[model samples]
Target: MFRCARAFSTSPLFKYAAMTCRQYSFQVFRDVPPLRQMRRQLLLDRKTVGFVPTMGALHEGHLSLIRQAATENTDVFVSIFVNPTQFGVNEDLSSYPRTWDSDVAKLEELNDEFARLGGDTGRISAILAPTPKVMYPTLPPSSEVDGDGSFVTITPLSRKLEGASRPVFFRGVATVCMKLFNIVQADRAYFGQKDVQQTVVIKRLVQDFYINTDIVIGDTVREHDGLAMSSRNVYLGARRRAVGLVIYDALKAAENAYNSGKLARSEILDAANGVASRVLSEQQALSPSERALYEVDYISLADPDTLDEVETIDPSKGAIISGAVKMVPLEESKPGEDCGLGDGKVPVRLIDNLIFKPRP
Candidate 1:
């Protein structure tokens, strides 16, 4: 039982990240003009730059991406903008954990980590903490756009998976990423593999739009107990956290099935769904207010490239098995409050994925 007790809990590898962390000096660019100016300078100087774009709340998963960005680029730039265009009116964009100062502190700590490792260029050079006013300057920050300003949407692709749930997600992601990629114009940008769909979308965005930056994807970092690290994990209060392990367990079941040579999609999905079904069974045994309201959204087996749902595993070309479980905490349940991601409550959505590979 990997029963983690608190929020933001992580492995010992990050023992001193947010705690005992030294604040290193870095540029905090808040507007477009200055950030663009700095970027132009970087390009003129022919210095290799790496970009790591993020929403505020910093965690180990985020840091690992920055670490990779540092190792490859002469300068690294991070953006911490909680994009309003990304969230629907009913979503928890307002309550979506914004630890700004702490986030900067984490970046400082990361820069210092690189400094200790005997490298100067590995440190983050600046951050674009733009405001809603600054980011959405003229365009309205509403997902329900009336097609006024230019918006990016990769049809069909943006309409599936996470997009199917929040139709505006990938549009917002593409729009913001394109905007940031324009602003920073870093030689390469870093992203984590955990947000698999987003990674696919961004890669397509760059390819289709002819964006200059290279998209570098680092492996997903996990907690000591194996849950993929996420900013939203904080919402999984102690009790729900334990049950949340079921999300990963389900993915593991699918992984095990595939590795065991059950290459049929039905076999793999059945194995995964069987593990996830425990949530419903467990719900019957718990009190209403104490339960982690896990309403199964989807357990998917799809092509890694087009994301088209697969019926059978293609050994020559692998597939990605992913799942999403909407978890709402009854203890803090607000019947009317919604995060847009889940039911009409501040739901703690759990999503995870694992790769299936056969040994040679």
Candidate 2:
């Protein structure tokens, strides 16, 4: 029987005095050899593996995936690598949330929950928390366009929507994920719907690459107020956090509007844009200075599959209405001043989406 190390119980992060949860320890590997060896052992034992890839900073949204994996597969491997490749030059790679201690605690919490439910114990058997150096020992030379270092790319799909905004984002995502898929060799891989396009891209990647794994997408988890949960959400200041709700509200409105028999693409876009505008207007009215803090990047209606703009929603096929907004915290500036966001303002970009399907 696997036993947790006594040190974990006394560790600051792993202390469970709050509740009488079962104590257990899963192997954590920092290098590739041990991880691969474990996978080999699992394969030799004829056990199926479910994989959950994450950037740490665990939340309920992430927990749902782990729970689903534990319930379905004989073994679950959760990777806690904060992949640096995915972040853009101007992105929050440095400032991105990294609560390693809290993350491990959440993993422990899930294992205990699984035990409490009489589900298979020790389902969460491995955690691969490799560092950038471990994942990629050598950096690409600067002269190369993308890089002399190896990378994976899914054309067309990688160049659309989210990719359009952050050009190299999907390439990095595809490369790292493909590496994970190769290393884990999981029977099933799980993803969340919060990143709708990313899920689509990964699904396509699996199909095209002929990887022997099933891709499962969990529903997007939301806060009580309907705001989609995200790791970047920690960057949102109080007012900006409240203001960010507009994305969800806007998507809900768009879905409702599509259900109301208005199929025109322009009309649907206008509906979501209107809701977002109203939310922004109200916030601005409450405090005019907040106006500079909220900016709608784009509101688009597109075919869910191809992600191309659709003139009409084929209720049978379904469609997606999505948008991104730039939310910033208050920066001290006079009413007539430029707001000067570079100095004190904390800006974070948020994205949300909704799917509309007509009733059959």
Candidate 3:
């Protein structure tokens, strides 16, 4: 027979012991705590916070900013307040999508993921769920009077583009954003380049008001076919969607002309118009039902910073090409025919921009 110690070591018990030891060498992970718990911990830990303000119908475009914030900042806060003051009387504020449940779900999902990755979940907070009365105190009855305004007015680089169309828009945006910055106390803020004008105005506001938030701008996200990602794109029907490509095509034509030694502003505008005209003409050939329906508002190229119309591309200064098109509805009668709608209006406004930076 074998010695007792040798027999014990060589037996299945010894093999099982070895296996258990190997398994023990590897680490076991417990389930991560929920974001709410992690956030509380982070807040207690004293982390710096960043913010992104949006009218939520959150998309990849918005998520990209959050991801950037996650990488660079200790905390991230997103506010989703659609301020009524920004919208014109005839604008789509009434029909603008507001999916609060889904928006909160997305924010919570992002917060939890960040938390699991050891990021400060408390940093990625949202302030959209509060009731109107609680968030904005009731104004005195006289505050609505012609000269009894209680809200502070922000005079920014308005009087152009969306500002020209919606005069009171930027004032409202600036005021609401000021409130958001005060509430969040963010060290940095993220904005997409799609709204170049709005970006300029916000920068001015921060500077003039002495707000201490660092602004970061993300690239404008676009569809595979080059149409800029926008919430209003949902309103486009089949034909209108096809016609929508004209905007992108026009922008590209203008860019190509600028790059290929064509410096004349008129020539560039002509190039854009050429592309738009071709598409419009083709659509006009189709039956009213088959044709895409839209009204071109304006096409312009301007200095990205000053927002003034630029005749020549300055290699040092960037330019922004922007325009708006109104979409007509399907099931409505022909262009001149009234569908009982007063102005024959199906305002599916499409706004897009292309930003050009000089080569190094």
lDDT of 3 by residue, 137-184 (tens): 565212121323334454546778877777767766776788777665
Clashes of each: 0, 0, 1
User: Model 3, stretches more than 4 Å misplaced?
Assistant: 1-44, 112-123, 140-156, 331-346
Candidate 1 deviant stretches above 4 angstroms: 1-24, 145-147, 331-345, 357-360
Higher-ranked by lDDT: 1 or 3: 1
Q: Residue 169 deviation, candidate 1, in Å?
A: 0.6
State each model's C-alpha RMSD to the native. 8.4, 5.8, 15.6
Taking all chains together, each candidate's TM-score versus the true structure is 0.87, 0.87, 0.78
Which one wins by TM-score: 1 or 3? 1
Q: All models: lDDT?
A: 0.78, 0.77, 0.66
Candidate 2, poorest ten consecutive residues by summed lDDT: 5-14
Per-residue alpha-carbon lDDT of model 1 for 311-341, expressed as tens digits? 9878877888888888755644445543243
